[model samples]
Target: MRRVPDVRPPALRPAAVLPGPAPRRGPVTVALAGAEFGWGSSGKLSAVLSALRERARLPLRFVGLASGLGRPLLAEHSVEHWYDLPDAAADRRAAVGRIVRSHGVRAAVVVLDGAIATALQAAGVPTVFVDSLPFLWTEGDRAALPLDATVYCAQQCVGLPPECEGILASVASLRWVEAVIGTPPAGSTGTPGTPGTRTWRKALVSLGGLGAPRLPDRTAYPRVVVPAVLDALAEHGVQEAHLAGNLPAGLLGGLVERPPAGLRVTAGPLPHSAFLSELTRCDVLLASPGLTTLLEAGRLGVPTVCLPPQNLSQIFNGRFHSRAVGVDVRVVWPENVFREEEALGLRAKGEDHALELIYGGIGRVAARADGTPGAAGLRAAVLAAVRRAAGGADWGALTAAVGTGGAAQVAEALLAIAGPTPARGA
Candidate 1:
């Protein structure tokens, strides 16, 4: 394995520096600006915020910029303040500035939202940007924010721009998950039914939040694919499966009401801790190529099969991370999946050309899983991949490459930028 590059910024150059043991003297407020894209970003932000609150041992306040899809989750996590980002740049900046001033926010952690980071930095609040997909980073993205620090939560370093100060750490989701699930026992190789044992019995299925409101209804994919996938798993001797994601409760209920025979299926949205704990118990993970889910499954050494992703970033993340870890995650592209009405609805959302291009591209890729041949091929491929992963993929080496203590390391960096805690009253 190649040596993990040292990408720490000069300011954070102290080797093995962890969050200081000293607790803050008084109340401190730090804003976490998370992207409105999916559960992955907000879920991660929530985990890190929780860690900072616990480790700092201070009366902390969390403020959030909630995306339409992310609002409920943010509310669920109890973010003290929530604001909907305005349409105009000036309006957005003004809104963020107002919040920072009103809350007296000392620092901010911007998760994948560069524009918000720029606004907070301009307001003179210390800021750190968490770049979950380093591969997606661009010079333009950095120029817009130019944050004080950039932390990459990835397995391998994909060299960032020379001008950008960067820190590479293990996937934050994995660190958070392990913190909750506890580490797997030493020398515990493979999940259940590795070679000598019976065929794999448990599977966890999840497609993270759709993230796009104008696209097809949430039930579209589940209505068509869940039965088939469950049936296939059951035929392969898989006895039980758990389905979890940001899907509506009604859709989950629809699936549970009519599950395939011989295969028990339970579905719901799980809290971060519960979700990770459950991942550790599953034999295989079937999920969208969200970086958080992928890394958590990889960390726990669970076999993973990635479904056709809704966007290009997910596709790239799935391919890049899978190869980096030597895990042959099969990507099953479903053909003819999007209905005409769904396509039109997405186009009508006012970003016509871009949406058309994206939808067209995804449609082409998804078309690959159109027939019995495609479906059977995917099922067989997933089974083989699961067997290989369960038998043992160099998970130790992968985790070592990523390193650990991500949340604390990031919290330390943020605190450093925030400067010394204020002195308490005499």
Candidate 2:
């Protein structure tokens, strides 16, 4: 087995043109919010907030209404103006209204949380709600009224509660398309096309979102699975396996000290943008079935092999992305990857499993480059929808209609309604 040197020779490609630095945009304020809730909720909410910040091309200000759990991480990108949550839900609504009116906001974009949606809707503000997780609720059930428009990431709401209703506007990623498109080219793997040093030539592994248990069987699953993946890759005659995502220090240090004969693992959390950039260079990815990572892999055109955690959410996510998107990949129990009936006893089941895995792997890799489906098309479509609703006039209606663009669209709508920056706020 051959190992890729930890270093690579620089690839002599033409320097990719960098977009001119993000222009500072305005006093047109919108809140990037989350329930001042738990870590899981905040992390999910932040992914949406980050996407909104990425798409806004014009000068703008973001006010965060929840706590700083997600905000501080975002401080490097732009100054976020946050509002404290009021004691009651009613007070929270009134507070948000005051903030919007004071800042002259035309739109409030909610990244598909029930509590956040309820607050903005109660305030009677025009809003664009980008619902990435349909399993949360159906559009009508979730939003009740015909929202100016709604956008969803998954195909129509399947597991959604009875309440959601709205036309399907677009499939948007919780991920920032800009993050993937802006990745720098990686240096070459000096080891050439040689097979890897261990049996596993190329391996990518991750435990999504801080290594918290994603499935019921998760606690012991990783312990059993990672070693199996390493062993299988070793058997396949690959040299090195790369580990990515949240890894505990003690366990990681232990792995490093003794180390698998030829395997190498890098530990520590990477800056979000940097991690996706590095993703361009990976051969295959192994991770818990998180929509964010799976979508990222799809965009990068990387083949993935997954072991679904035994939790309902992880199971649903794994099944959905694999079967629906028709990506080429494998999603199986750990036992399946190593079991041997040789061929006869479990022939049909084994064949079906192999086909699904291989098909998903090859299919997703062939789908498209990450971030290729530009948001411009959606923006144009949204503007048209808002215009028709407005009878070709500028009104606050556009805010409700443009759901996916979030900050950028809201800023545009505000420009249409409130006009340019004026003297000082009253």
- TM-score top scorer: 1
For residues 314-338, could you state the per-residue lDDT of candidate 1 as single tens digits?
6555565567556665554544443
User: For every candidate structure, what is the RMSD over all alpha carbons to the true structure, in angstroms?
Assistant: 7.0, 17.3
The candidate that wins on lDDT is 1
TM-score of each: 0.74, 0.53
Which digits, one per residue and each the tens of the lDDT, describe model 2 over residues 1-426? 121122211221111211345334445555555432212233334444454444444455666666444444344446456766665767867887777677666445554344555566556655544444444233324333223432222322223322222222322321111111112234521121122221224556666433322212222334434554554444444455666554445556544344456666555544445555556666555666655455445545454554543222444456544443333234444233322222112223322343334323323322446311222332233223222222211111111121223233332332333223433433
How accurate locally is residue 354 in candidate 1, as Cα lDDT from 0 to 100? 34
Model 1 spans with C-alpha error above 4 angstroms: 1-25, 71-78, 138-198, 213-225, 324-327, 334-358, 361-384, 387-392, 395-397, 421-426
